[model samples]
Target: MFANPMILFIQVMNSLSLAMNLFIIAAGLTLIFGVLRIVNFAHGAFYMVGAYVALSILRVTGDSNLGFLLGVLGAGALMGAMAFVVERGLLSRLYDKEHMLQLLFTFALVLVIKDLVKMIWGSGQYSIGAPPFLRGAVNLGISPYPKYALFLCVMGPIIAVAIWFFMERTRWGRILRAAREDRVMLNALGTDVKLVYSGVFVTGAALAAMGGALAAPRSAVDPGMDSLVIIDAFIIVIIGGLGSLLGSFVGALILGFLTVMGSIYLKEWVIVASYVMMVVILLVRPWGLFGKADEERH
Candidate 1:
């Protein structure tokens, strides 16, 4: 099997796409957790909504490259605004409350979002077709696969770089990073803490939503997706080291490769194998592969 270089390369490409999607969701999650100190369980809901939004837009706009881009951006903006409302209207008040209460509130949000999606889209599985340009495979002299996946693989790192640049080079990113380090001091120094929190939530939610949109063509959108995506996301977040963007990327790649390889080699026990890998990672490096302890230290 190893002799089939094309097979190996395609599998590698598949793993990369999966990793990219995971990174998109986890990047937002890490940022939010890094700054807000709240584990927003509603993130999965945001992702689900994104898939639905993209599906709807694509259905209306027909299959085209422009439609896909519009669908992704539209999903991002819509979810970002929704997160803004949720953060400001509901989660904002719970900031000082206990962790249980905070989790409960987000948990309720998960249910609410689920029902809302069902009501709007109905409880049915749906998928989007790849745009005309992305329909076929880029032949690697072996088995051909979808070109869209390759596009996703490229776009993923471009996005990651953009996010890193924003966080490290821009003033807003600096302010956000500063807020993550010490909200109390930032507030004391006259920075508007509430606004910063809202911005972070919106940014994170937007990325999660876009991830859903990007994954829509490859995966079906349905009711159980919220729970399903969240579980994978949780693993990615934990493995990457909580609140570390770079960690999220690394963690996603590891899980992506493990899942792809396991499915190919251990089809009967793929799920079990994946979790076992996670267990080993956690046992050896509880803080995650590139994650440092005390992430909030300024």
Candidate 2:
């Protein structure tokens, strides 16, 4: 199957697109885990909700780049605001509680958000056509490839760089990193740890939502979509190493390539192939490819 150059090129491009999408979502998951020490099970729910919200926005604005941009921004802002509420009203109370409680609370949030989505959007699958400028295909010497997929290929890295710059260059980003190192010490310096935590959670949620909104134009928006992406995001995070942004990017790329290739070669066993790879990698390096062993403390 790899003998065909055109087929290989298209699959490679597709994998790149997939890797970037997974990175965006998994990056948020890792960031939340890194700072708040909470495994947000509802991250996927936010992703799903973003897609639905984007779809609604697109319906109102029609087929234009501005419409897509609004959809993505609106979805992110909405999810971020919702995250603020969740962090303040519920998650705030659980900080001193057992890890189990945090897990259960977030898991419960998954169900609540899913049901709420069902109520609002029903169970139907919806899709948005690519913006006019992105609707066609690009000639890649071998054959034509989707312009939107190419756009996604570029978008992933742009987002990653932006995130890196934000974390590395900004004062709030420095505070966030400091909080990750030691919240108690950060608080002692008169920084509002609570506010920082809330901000981190909201930002992470917004990134997940933005990822979903961006993906909506490429795939169908439907019920249970959150479940699917969440599983993939978890796999990426685990493989990349919890709390490591670089790990998330590398892990996403590995999984994306494996999944795309496995679908072509292993057929129905593609998922098993991914897990097998994970197991093998874990056996070799328990903390993941770029993850540090000491970062596991909660």
Candidate 3:
């Protein structure tokens, strides 16, 4: 009956690991919405690009721990650079356009990126093994735990704290918040709203890419992987409340636990469970668990 302490410990670790990885992805989605007010459907594409790009780098660098590190950083940087170009060259032009047009633009971007990825990487599944150092298990009191999973658990909290500090304590963070509230006024104040928007988009894309790179050790990198992940990311953001980072963190944890537990119990019905949770949350608190009402946001 899933009662063993060791079993519970393992499940906890699995859940935490999944939650952390998912949080990494969902945080970027939420951040983009927080400032730019754009619901980027292409975030998942950015994530997939990161994994593929990292895979390319690791192939060249011999897949050492250093190579993995380089791949992760490089993926982030490359995606960031690409994002800057897109933001400045294309997306910025649509800033004043209608939301429907924005949606079409991003949706088109998704198709373009997907096709481009297939052209470059072909249609094949590839796996990225964890660094040799992280391939083993570590003793965690009652049961042995995977080093990679443990690393993710620790990393999740560290990233959450770092982002929290950046958003709450830093000067640019304040500008970002102010820009989110009133981009026109911020621009009037000589803050270079376009530059700030570009930075936000770049940071968001880089985060997605880095998240993909970090996750490659555990998942298959393949075409169309972004499709399912976009669903997960959107669910997290919607339930967490769009534009709310704290909400995304908590929501990711919730989805992570539900996903791990449901896979054990419900099997194929696990997806149904996620939908149910989303539905109930929507019914009870449309604003999300940690999200504010739209009126409050205004």
Error of 1 at 265 (Å): 2.5
lDDT (Cα, tens digit) per residue for candidate 1, span 169-241: 9988888888878789899999899999999999999998999998888888888887888888888888888
Q: Put the candidates in TM-score order, highest first.
A: 3, 2, 1
* C-alpha-based local distance difference test score of model 2: 0.90
- In candidate 1 the C-alpha lDDT for residue 116 amounts to 95
Scored by lDDT, the top model is 3
For lDDT, candidate 2 versus 3, the one ahead is 3
Candidates, ranked, lDDT: 3, 2, 1
Q: Which residue pairs overlap in candidate 2's backbone?
A: none
Q: Please give the clash total of every predicted structure, in order.
A: 0, 0, 0
- Which structure among the candidates has the greatest TM-score? 3
Superposed by TM-score, candidate 1 places the C-alpha of residue 70 at a distance from the truth, in angstroms, of: 1.2
Residues 1-298, model 3: lDDT tens digits: 3679899889988999999999999999999999999999999999999999999999999869999999999999999999999899999999999998888988999999999999999999998889888899999899999999988898888888888899899999999999989999999999988888999999999999999999999889998788878899999998988888899999999999999989998899997988899899999999888888878877
- List of clashing residue pairs for candidate 1: none
